[model samples]
Target: MTTHHRTRWLALPAALLLALLPASASAYPNPGRVTGDITVHDPTMLRAADGTYLLYSTHGGLEARTSTDRIAFSRSGNAFNSPPSWWKTYSSGNDPWAPDISYRGGKYLMYYAVSSFGSSTSAIGFATSSSGKAGTWTDYGIVHSTTGSSNYNAIDPNLFVDDDGKWWLSFGSWWSGLKMIRLDPATGKSYAGDKTVYGIASRPTGTKAVEGPSVVKRNGYYYLFASYDTCCAGTSSTYKIKVGRATSPTGPYYDKNGVAMMNNGGSPVLESHGRYIGPGGQSIMSDTDGDLLVYHYYDGQAGGTAKLGVNLLSWSGGWPTAY
Candidate 1:
């Protein structure tokens, strides 16, 4: 959906709001308080076994930050002390974006993207580390890629492993919407046999504005969350988080009203309200308290600078509602 479309949705009556969101979006809560080195874009947060929060965001070689109590974060170092030499083959700047980190097989795996702005000549790369801290990444090279000839742009990667031990990587942007491919667990790359790129979600008619997919399984359902509309416009950005659910990981996912995600179907998880504008690029982390919605939003009070916003999710009604 476009910013104009979202603006109209915001103007709808309360009853109409129910058609687009799980609840009346006018009452969406402000983000939980955070301080110190909060500025970020496309933030992906992971808490290590030692109780430290390692947060990564876009650009500057995937800038890294850390926090102990989750309230006060401090700037750390970039994941790469030097950009991988192979990066220049795909990205002109050699700067990476949207790094997704996960722990599996007693190792830390990070999947990131190398691309320039508004371009489809992009590549998705992978790295592994014994520890997920800064300067420890060992580049495994490109996992998937796309050229200007391709319909999809390969970026914003999210890895979802199912209960049956299947690995899937979902990544895409503007041109043809979200795409997923089965991954080999051992190599952390695309599976050779089933190389089909699954089309998960898109806006066919209006703005093709969905990206940043994060999938998590809860109570027998696999939820696919994505950012909608414009990002990086600071306070003017219309970015918000939307979600759909399916029984399988590579899904014909559906929203609350049974609309298919592939047909532009999504129920609002978070959106612009008050000082919090354009809350998106979200990742779900199951914390000690509950499922934390970790994302970045343009802070209206801070000259529209991007900042981290964390909110606990309530899944009481079988759909995620942020409190």
Candidate 2:
């Protein structure tokens, strides 16, 4: 096993130290208090080895923010000094969205998507950094992409490294739901041996508004968390986070009710409530305290501005409950 894998397993005990007492299921808890530079979209965060929190989000060449205590964040800079030239091929304006960051193989890797609004022609790009800081990333080009004629869209990339050292990337939007591809750990690119695109979740019958997938393993089950319904509409957005689980990383995921995720089945994790409107675009982080549900929500009190939302999760009954 690799040293990285060994370190991760040793840290699992602390990462799985969730709250024993579950929160009321009906009451969606408000986000934990945060201040300064909280406005963000599709935020992906990870605590560096030095204990500084690094956050990267959509736009502004993948805008960045840093926090010493995970509360008062300050805008650091963009991940890239300038948008890569290849980005213009998918997005005329060089817009990228929904970045997923991780520490693997002794390096910080980031996967982000580039595409124009309502377009299936999108590309997921990869980059690497030694320090997990803005302006230090070196773009490695596209990892996966889709054309207008493809059945699925390739945006919102999330990398999931299994317990046995296998890497899987889950991403998609609007066309045919979420999909996953095996990754070669050496290259951080798609595995040449396995070209099969696995469909993990979808909404086949109703609105195909499911996207932004984040996968994590806990208690012998692989949980798939995704956003559902329309997003980016501010106060009118119906975006919410939902979840399903399977025994394998490449899954036939089922919701709490045993309904298949491909058939519009997902148990709600977080939804629009009170001043927190359209809560979605979530990523799960294993922090010192516990598992955290980190995402963005439109602030009703702030004129529909997108802001960062953080809440600890409890795995009281084998399923995660965001509190």
Candidate 3:
């Protein structure tokens, strides 16, 4: 929630930020238009099993794109298309950043990012695809790593299975802001103990361009959601989209003015308009005609490139509003 209006330099070229974002974010649609031609970053969603609706993103690598109507997408490739072979040993060939998908043993896993970004040596890899089909990945290697320490650079990863089923995995950035533990539910790969439990810290200048962390749980509470500033750097990006809330599942959360995004403070659920530069890497899915807000923004309509938006969120009085 800090915008005194100063960051600008957008020369508008990537096809005009893709024709002023589907002709100005497609004004009013009962809430349902997000189309422009797939650019995705940090953004992630999955429903498959023939229902179709798979979007996943990340920068410098990872990428996966698709859409059933969340607004026209297509590029379903490079879920690390072909980078292993010891990937330049520590970071040059398989930088494959951000990739998160779920659906256990019956297979679909995903959860990627091998990293070198701000280096802690980085790693959080895993891949499987029982015909979830996106060129059929199958790595399943470093299911979680950390070589030295940026305190926790390991890379933005997210996974879930709560409500008592356990299986957790949130990640961190900026030395330590978001962190979680307990994982292992049937080999989601390691950790059921070194106990980090959960922690949040949205940047009180400890210098965390925040970092994408996503979670969900509606009515019973537990929201999380992070993206705070500076991502992908396409239009001098200074990202946005922040949130908090917690009824447990590791958090002191809070936010809609009750403050406490670990106290660094946060509130606005989404920001940036007119050109949508640096929106965020968020996630949300609910259905039955409810919440949507899947993310990735920065298209003054594709000239600033980096597409995919999909709003249609609501909760109004309890927060989480998007349109």
Number of clashes recorded per candidate: 0, 0, 9
Give the runs in model 3 whose Cα sits over 4 Å from its true position.
Answer: 1-63, 66-69, 72-75, 84-95, 99-112, 115-120, 123-146, 157-175, 178-292, 295-309, 313-320
Model 3 residue 244 CA deviation (Å) reads: 8.4
TM-score of each: 0.91, 0.92, 0.31
TM-score quality measure for candidate 1? 0.91
lDDT of 2 by residue, 92-177 (tens): 98988999999987999999999999999999999999998999999999999999999999999999999999999999998889
Of 1 and 3, the candidate ranking higher by lDDT: 1
| C-alpha lDDT (0 to 100) for residue 282 of candidate 3 | 76
Report lDDT (Cα) of residue 29, candidate 2: 71
Candidate 1 on 141-249: residue-level lDDT in tens?
Answer: 9999999899989999999999989999998888879999999997999999899999999889799999999999998999999999999999899999999999989
Against the reference, the lDDT scores of all candidates come to 0.89, 0.92, 0.70
Kindly state the number of residue pairs that clash in model 2.
0
Runs with alpha carbons beyond 4 Å of true place in candidate 2 = 1-26
**Candidate 1, pairs of clashing residues:** none
Candidate closer to the true structure by TM-score (higher is better), 1 or 3:
1
